[model samples]
Target: MSGYFVTEGSKCKGRPLTTLPVVINRDLSRIINNNLQLKSSHDLEHLRYIAQQRDEWTKLTARIQEAAEASQSEH
Candidate 1:
C-alpha cells in the first residue's frame, strides 16, 4: 500500500514525509517507485555487509534471520 493521496495535477506528499499511494492512483507511483529503489539499495547494503563479515558470519546469519522475521511480522 502507498502512503499518499492526490489533488489537482501536481503530486503532493502522502503524509508530509511519506511516499504516495500507487494502487489508489498512478500519480503517486513515481514517488513510490523512488522509495522502492532506495529500499532496494538499503537491502543490498545489508546483504553486502553480511557477505563481508565472514569471520562472524554464523552470528550474522542468526542476526539476519531475526531481522527478517521481525520485518515479516511488521507486514
Candidate 2:
C-alpha cells in the first residue's frame, strides 16, 4: 500500500492544480527495493532503448514549451 503520489502542474491564473496517483505494483516495487541490476545483454539494450526514448521525449517537451512561450509572448 506504500507508493508514490505524483502531483504535477502549476496553478496558473488562479486555477487549482490536481494531483495524480502513480501506483507502483508489487513486482516493480520489489524489483526497485532489491536494487535493479542489468544481468544480460537484453537488459542492457532495453535500458538503452528506454534512455533514448526518454531523451527524445525531453527534447519534444522542450520544443513544445518553447513554442507555447513564444505564442504567449506574441499577445
Candidate 3:
C-alpha cells in the first residue's frame, strides 16, 4: 500500500501524506449559550490546548537539537 506505513506491528493506512487529528466538542452549543462573558470556557479550553501543544513542541525540539549535536560530535 503506497499510503500505508508500518509501525511496530500494526499497519496504518490513510489518505494523502498530511493529516491532523481534530476533536470538536459536542457541548459547544451549550457552552456558547451560557454567556461565558469574560474569557469564555471555550476560549480557556483553546488556551490550555495551545499551551499543551507548545510544551510538546518545545520538548520535541529540544530532543531533536540534542540528537543533532550528538550525531555531529560522532562524525
In the order shown, the candidates' Cα RMSDs to the true structure are 12.4, 15.2, 16.5
TM-score of each: 0.28, 0.32, 0.32
User: Best by lDDT, which number?
Assistant: 1
Candidate 1, backbone clash total? 3
Relative to the true structure, candidate 2 reaches a TM of 0.32
Range of the 10 consecutive residues with the lowest summed lDDT in candidate 1: 24-33
Q: 40-75, model 1: which lDDT tens digit per residue?
A: 444445546655888655765455466556667989
Candidate 2, residues 1-75: lDDT per residue as tens digits? 112222357435764343221121222222322332344445445545654898854754455466556667989
All candidates in order of TM-score, best leading: 3, 2, 1
The pairs that clash in candidate 3 are none
Residue 28, model 1: Cα distance from true site in angstroms: 28
TM-score for model 3?
A: 0.32
The alpha-carbon lDDT assigned to residue 8 of candidate 3 equals 52
